[model samples]
Target: MVSLTRISEYVAQTANIIGGVLELDVLIVDRSLRIIGDSDLASVSEEECIRKDSILAKVMAEKEQIILSSKEHNAGCASCLQRNLCMVEMIIGIPIFFESKILGSIGIIANTLYDKEKMINNQENYLKFIDRMIELLTNRLKEEQALEEISLLKKRMEVVLDSIDDFLVLVSRDGEILQTNLNFKNIFKRKKPKYLNEVLCADVVDQLLNDSEEVKFKEVKVNKIHDFLLSSKPVIVDQKDHGALLSFKSIKDVAVEMNELYTHSMDVVFDDLVGESPQINMVKERIKQIASSSSTVLIDGETGTGKEVIARLIHNTSTRSNAPFVAINCSAIPEDLMESELFGYEEGAFSGAKKGGKIGKFQLASGGTIFLDEIGEMALHLQSKLLRVLQERQVNKIGGLESTEVDVRILAATNKRLEDLVKQGRFREDLYYRLKVIPITSPPLRERKDDIRLLVDYFISYYASRIGKDINGISDNAMGILMEHPWKGNVRELRNVIEFSINMSTGDMITQTSLPFDLVHPTQEYDEDLNIEVVTQRLIEKALIKYGDSTIAKEMAAKSLGISVATLYRKMKELDLKNSIG
Candidate 1:
């Protein structure tokens, strides 16, 4: 007989293998007469096995071997209800027995009269062999089923561990690393280390393990950067310690939430910028080339393109790295107060001046760099003063008699086209030329789609650590969606999307369902944004209010908006603003 191997489904595989070796075709059925396994020839006569009055069913109900010899087939052929369709002249059905109970039945069909006499002569021997085969197959199937269940359980446990935000490590009693979650691997950026000390915070791990008392949730600084609470529990097997389960929480989050720290200053090394794209390499090379220069640099890109990050990199690599790098948003400050904020006011200089003269951003950044973000938004009068400061490398604080001699390098950034602003007489032409001495434009995220995968991994690791979730990675489908997105908000939008996904995800891997509603249904979000038509109408109303309500004023407003008078008139009519304008 042919050998039997384990099958995935709950069925006997031995019957078909045995049939292949013997001339007799075989069919195996369960208690309900469900055909579980059949030989090649038996497959053609499948209808014969499952019938209520079938030989296999009769054998199963009788719990004994039933043989239809040639004499029995010929003598009772007319009376048998299935005689017309029955092809076998002689057939034997043996009940499959396990632990004194009937499991099912296995049928063997003889092809010739000579074979039928051979089957009848060896009926007792066949019964004993069939009983042994059934017993062996039953035991084998039970073992395989148990193993399959255990495998599934282990998989489920791993998935649960991966979803946790904290660093989780399973270490043997001998201090060997057994397993670890993505959060732990992300910080070290390596595969699981053989030894615990090689990857974990050595000091924290040592303290937690060596401590005699329970040391759960003990706060410690890992690698002098991450503040984490270490928790360790002994995995007792048979009342003996088998291993340890180590988990950690980020105490840095608690510090921020409790208002113990207002801001965190992470060292922005060039290596921290994660991208291998040629565009990013070029930007890195440019930063290196101009790091030591004192010339004013103009950084330009859409919002969230990391303009401020590049500016900081320049300051960190410069000769004045030890000095302060002051940054100010030119547009964020009120127009009336921007001048005083940039150049400190003397005591009694304004209605509410400080008791002593305050050091302005220029004086504060002396011997260093002052980053002027949104510099294009500076008022015309302030631009002229700023131009003089850049030229002379000194600052004359507001309401101060003597000019304060300062040595500061100015680095300005803007999303607007300063050249267009200059042509429109909104920005000073001279100032634009001065700031663009060493211009660098940061590439938008969409332009660097090749880097999206790298960036996504970085963001997943970063936000997962921050929020204390155990997100290990993203699904392939989710990453594809991210790469395809236009990323209008650039890197900032990508970061937000990742953060949103990490929070919403219920599993270790960020799946499609974890994506934000707006991202999942982008058209709906687009339509929602399009519903802001009132913003455009409000802009037209403000322009008319500032100029005048007359046709002449409307012409001037249209010129400022870079649109023709007729277009403006048509838009006003379309927006139902014909009566509102004077």
Candidate 2:
């Protein structure tokens, strides 16, 4: 609703002009019948100026003009209770209308006989002048309302632009900086530049202004120092170029986003290794000591000895844990594509290359760690390129002229010894030494037999929960079979065995009957000394040596031997093995 008070000043000025020209008092009242403008000091107060029975009120109610000469006989003022107080002999009232709605009324009053005669003689001209004044006041109010709405819309647009995370700028077609978002202002310390060239290079600005389609470029230098990924889209309206909207993302931020997109949700932490043996503890301590370093690491171990697990643990415990931990199995990918897979490739590098090129594991692992498993399997030609990357801390994409700098920590694992491979001319000596800056060896399960019990308990609980079973523990007979079997496949093989046993077991406990057939009944040669007593004595002696001669050791040895501690003690006493301790 448009209020007449919004144009109160214009109403006052219009009333003064008409009153001065016609030599009569003028008064203006709003739609609510409240006087808002008065040309002369009226004897009546503002609240009492307009009455229900006044001529001005009748004109507004009827949405028309009214002219009266005699206040006592005019029908427009006959019912006015305050008509006696009104000092007027003639009156002209015109109602203001806008959009078919009456906003207010304008009245011309004649207090003297000469003024009354003057108004009655020129009543037509007086109405015409007041009508023109109403039109001007209505137009003024519309303009003010439009300006207010535009201001509100501009504020809303600014808020929307500032909410973006990336630095954004609106520029003219001639590269003039028009407006910028909050991120851009923050980066520049709230000091706005005059043109795009003040922040971006001339060539980049040129490409943004001239390109018809959306333009995107990475590693673009900002202010000749910092690198950013820039993208621009021309603002086209009705087949005319207005300007361009540019967005800048930090290269480091882009790398982090890519890492998140490419990373898996394995959630492998340092504690997930789950071992208490000396060999395993030593490996864990070594990882903790060097977790903050950025040097290259070389891990050598037998297959299934948890080399990749150790690498992941190191990454998880390091400062770069929040970033990506990319693992590439050299033996898994083909040798022909190993180079491209390691160092990325250009769009047209090879015959069947992907259209937009592909980012390699190293690039994806930037600002974090990359593990190269089975490094010995990498070809000699690729080794040279790998050496160059390690030496320069940069990578050259295939069929690309420039090298891209990478801030990645390299970690390589192999089941075979790189030293022996280098001696055999299969691996480069320089590259081997470079990778061995921090060498670690993952101990096989056989060497860390002390951790077997813990590993068994962990795997049992894990597999049982995963398979939704109630199996709680492994029986002595089942554990004895596992302790005696040599695990050539190490932890991986042990895990599979436990999973198989859990699946095969029908009861709440895993027993020897649930074991694999080949594991429970292995082929054995006939013994030359077939005496039962001698065999039993020899087995007891061996168990005593393997475990200590303490009472707890005897209990553990008895469990491994698939016997009770009391039976083992009885046999020891019968065999006269007196070296046992309580």
Candidate 3:
């Protein structure tokens, strides 16, 4: 569908040139026989449509040249509808061809007898001249088509570049700025720089242009002091370096991506802390009051008292909830590796450092919160570093030349008394005060005994559904035993006890026998008037009844009674109770 109208200006100029040189009028029509070019408009109207049976239409249909003379009464023009009105004495119509496909037809008409005689005498020369004009027109059309396709491709490329979130720039091998995307333009709020050195520092520009290989994740400042993670690759075409493509991603945005990748248990919200006691309610209120602030929090509690749970609740309700919540156990990691792990390290900083270096927990938790569990166990030297980081809101990586600014909220938890550690010179006093900007205490389960029933129900429902059991409730005797036992391990221990009971139960309810052996037969308290011999005899009888008389059963009984198998056998023989075995 390459139409002659697309190059109408060229076609018109060529028609006029032919008319001036040969003293003959010319007309050019497209594939549909629509008149698009005319040299002498006085003879044929510019909008005239050629008749299908005309000599020019016949030439186009046959894809060949046709010559007719008025005096010869040519049969080709005999069928023309306007034969009487035709003013031509002689004419030559030739089909314009490109790549074996006819695009249109060009008609050269001789109106006067002098012109007609001139054309007839030099017929071979005239045909050759017109064929050359057709060649020029086809070449012009090809150039126009190429320009059209290039324009379309450029528009598509712009759309793709604008959709990217990162700032993008295209540079030449000489470091001249060739192009930039919309993000780059918006950030700088000005026209693109003429050269890479105009925006990036000289050293960065040198690395980008001369590297010949891709540069990845190089932290650099652009337009003076804006931090970015810059990546660049040389643009190569046909084994020759053309230029390079540079992409700059904002460091804050990168932090969010890393947070999403590493942070876990994102669903731990305030409601997940299941408790309803005066102490627990007061703690909840305090969390709600202070969650909006960015001050450091020190949570003090015994083991299994849900200190980490309170920290997560505070974080989930804070302004940084949408960001990361990184948790690290200070005691779990070795003292040798704690510094590098918390603050990160650069390439070659140590004997076994990663090639590209590593981002620290603080950087990953930027615009978020970081929880340090068992902070009292951190080394004294590390405590000094941690205090400096808290004071300055910055982190100096291992072997790094400069410190990086961070915007992370610190939350440290310890079961031990940090004050006593400071008194003993085991922990830094200044660091201890710095960490406790806001102090929180997680109450043990013994203090919140009223929540025991609710916690038990919650755990039973949770573990029953997970283990696919049909447990309904605990028997009154079992409940009394749980309530009277001192929960030294707190809520975590209670949850474990409930899970154990559900697994051990065969019926819908958790009876006394369904509980663990230790829970069912706790050691009794003796008074001053109690007889030690009588008490020992009754304990042995009860143990034998509960456990069978087999060897394994006796071993279990002896273990439960806090004695060895031989000691239990000697005591039974001395007490004359050997006949008691079933």
**Candidate 2 lDDT over residue span 447-507, tens digit each:** 9888888999999999999999999999998999899888889999899999999999999
Q: State the TM-score for model 3.
A: 0.76
- Flag the better candidate by TM-score, 1 or 2: 2
User: In what order do the candidates fall by lDDT, top score first?
Assistant: 3, 2, 1
Query: Each candidate's TM vs. the true structure?
Result: 0.47, 0.72, 0.76
Deviating ranges (above 4 Å) for candidate 2? 1-150, 261-264, 334-364, 398-404, 496-507, 510-582
Q: For model 1, give the 10-residue run with minimal summed lDDT.
A: 1-10
- Tens digit per residue, CA lDDT, model 3, 1-582: 677888877787888898888878888888888887878744445467877767778788899998887734666467666668877898799999988898989999988889899998999999999989988999998998888889889989999999999989999999988988898888778555788898888977887888788877776778876778788989999999988999999877787776677655455776667789999998899999997999999998889989989998899899999888888999999999998889988767989986546677887788899999999999999998899899999998897998999899999999876765675679999998998999999998989888888888888898999999999998899999999888889988888899999999999998898888987787656654388887887788778755646678679989999999998898898878777644
Candidate 1 lDDT: 0.76
| Per-residue accuracy of model 1 over 1-582 as CA lDDT, tens digit each | 111224413344577665765556778887767777777633323343376767788787888977777535444455678766766767778887655677788888887777677778887877777777677777876676678789889888888888987888888877787888878777766444688676457655565456423455554445445646677787778877667888877643332332223212733779666688888888899989987788899998888999988888888898867666778899899999888878877656888875534556676566677899998889999999999998887777778877767778899999876775775688999989999999998888888889888889999999999999999999988888887788999989999999999999999999999998778767833444555667677778777755555668789988887789998888899999977753
User: lDDT of each model, Cα atoms only?
Assistant: 0.76, 0.83, 0.85
Candidate 1 regions off by >4 Å? 1-266, 524-582
Off by over 4 Å in 3: 14-23, 40-85, 96-102, 117-136, 459-489, 492-582
Candidate 2 weakest ten by summed lDDT: 41-50
Q: Of the candidates shown, which would achieve the greatest lDDT relative to the real structure?
A: 3
